[model samples]
Target: MSLNEWFERGISKEEYIDSLQKHRDNFLHIYENFSVPTSDSLSNKENIRTIVLAEEWCGHCMLNIPILLRLTEQANIPIRFLPRDENLELMDQYTVDGKRYIPIVIFIDQEGNEVAKWGPMAPEVKELVEKLKVNVPTKDSPDYEGAFRQYVKEIVDVFRHDAAYWNYVYEDMIKSLP
Candidate 1:
């Protein structure tokens, strides 16, 4: 199917948020409090729509999707949510290193041609995640699973409450727009 057809199949923001189980509160928290910075660059955008490839269970998606929602809402752009697992046909096109990533937001023109895309993490956020991963033990180590879970928890905790990280995501997303 074409990108436009895939986008048409996506759920609305209300449906997507309502269906969220794991990060519904986190999503709400961000949406309620975060504000998009004024951007002349975003002011004149016309005939643009955004499609988000995400899964509710993904921590990265949990962190990024809400911000995107707030951004698109403020910018007056139409946005749709396409669950990553159910829509791998489209996700497959946006893979990194042959692996899929969640919370990839694509901006498409009226013709459904991609203008730009943002995903997975802001550069600063990615650096922080890499730093956090440095201490996780290998699979052979007995503490590996526990350590990894702890790392995930730590990242989510930061992602949920840190305005700096949220700003990083917002700024990067703004840079990604047409």
Candidate 2:
């Protein structure tokens, strides 16, 4: 379904936040940093409409989509969500490295042409995740899940403490208009 249909289905931002479950704390920290101004002159500057493909249960989705929502809401740019799992056709077109990734956002111009897309994670955060994924032990290891959870916690701590870093992500995403 399109984002309009999703919104009509009551898959709202509040519901998505609640569905974060154990990941809500980390998302809350990020959401706090995604500051929206009282007036955003940037709204409709490029006349862009956005569709966010995401899933609430996704760790990466919980982190980035809230930021996307904040920026779009501030800009007064209409935005919608389509669950990545249920929308394979749309997700396949904007895959991260040829694989479906949650929170892949598609931007459309007023004339119905595609403008740009962004997703999965912020750039620096993606770099951190790549490194952590390699270093963290797999299920074959006896204490695999524990080590992995620790790594995940470390990343979330970075989000909580590193405001400047995440701000860059917000800026870069907004500045991507062309």
In the range 1-178, model 2's lDDT, one tens digit per residue, is: 5534433443556666666776677788788766855454674544877777887677777667767877777776767676788878767777767888777877776665667777666778878788877868778998888888888777777766777656656766776755
The lDDT, on a scale of 0 to 1, for candidate 1 is 0.87
TM-score for all models, in order of appearance: 0.94, 0.80
lDDT of 1 by residue, 1-178 (tens): 8778877998999998888898788778887878887653466675889989998888898888888888887778998889888888899999987889778898998888899999878999989999999989998999999999999889988988998999999999988887
* Residue-level lDDT for 96 in candidate 2: 69
Choose the strongest candidate by TM-score.
1
lDDT of each structure? 0.87, 0.71
TM-score of 2: 0.80
